[model samples]
Target: MKYSKATDYALHTMLFLVAATPNKPIGVQQLADRQNVSPTYLSKILTKLVKAGMVESASGANGGYRLKRNWENISFLDIIHAVEGTASLFDCSFDHGSECPIQQVVLSAEAKMEEHLRNQTMFDLAKKNKNKIVW
Candidate 1:
């Protein structure tokens, strides 16, 4: 499945935060510049994360966002759900009335796909990155 840009930013921001030294609140501009994304776009991304209670925000001179929980506690599904809402890979309503046989197959396939995505977590993703990537 294709992940959205919002999910990409959220993942990058979380990984950057996870890699940061203790007690350092990363500024949005810094995250934007480092990730090479627009600051405005990152701000909007963070806003959704904040609303979902995945990340916390601070205000004033020494203000920025930090995770509400540890990296291990934050799941990819959690982030994806926050950014994109639930993965409704199937909607087999068939005009809101009839049940088509083709739709039944589609729904079953979608359910399996959804299960795979839901079972995935950021920690699992991090582990994969840990060996293959460096920065």
Candidate 2:
């Protein structure tokens, strides 16, 4: 499955926050500038993270955002679920209303793939140690 720019930015922004001090809130503008993303777009992503309780926001000069959980605790799947939603790859897994058996098999396999990604945390994706992202 391909990740949208929103997901990519979310990951980059989250990692930036993760590397920051617990008490320090990095400004949205700063994040955007550093990641070369639009601040407006980044704000939308930040809103999702805030709503998901992945990050906390405050207003003013010292206001920005801080991770609600440690880097290790926050997973890539969590970010995707927070923004895109917890949409399973399979349209219907538990309940099969279609009459086609082939559809059922496809759905089962799709479900398994989704489950695999869900189980693989963000920590797994960000396995490299302080290396320049070659993307």
Candidate 3:
């Protein structure tokens, strides 16, 4: 059930973008500083987010990353999938086919978790914590 550090960073980065300045671009160095991570490493995560259409990048001075127009509709699941991919968390090693009882239980749990994540969006979180400093 564990997700990658990249996923964790991506989620936090999205939340920071939404809460701090949804419409304004934030530099990658600033974002990395906030998380105590390397800008180069964070850039890779941002690339995935860009490809997923969650965020867009700008070039030149005052250029960086900002939440996309449809960011309000982006769910947690979307961010997770962007970094982690859509593969099932648990794949039964035994060739018990799709009907494997253990696999079925794990998949069911994953579905419920995904459903919960899908219901929660960055906008919802940002709005809830509007008064607080995201970083």
Highest lDDT among the candidates is held by which one? 3
Model 3 alpha-carbon drift over 4 Å, by segment? none
TM-score between candidate 1 and the true structure:
0.76
TM-score winner between candidates 1 and 2: 1
Q: For residues 40-120, could you state the per-residue lDDT of candidate 1 as single tens digits?
A: 999999999889987778887878887676646676667878888885656654575336777777778767776786777
| Model 2, position 95: C-alpha lDDT score | 57
Worst 10 residues of 1 by lDDT: 89-98
Give the higher-TM-score candidate: 1 or 3. Answer: 3
Ranking by TM-score: 3, 1, 2
User: What TM-score does structure 3 among the candidates reach?
Assistant: 0.96
TM-score of 2: 0.75
Instruction: Spell out the clash pairs found in candidate 3.
Output: none
Clashes of 2: 1
* Candidate 2, position 49, lDDT: 95
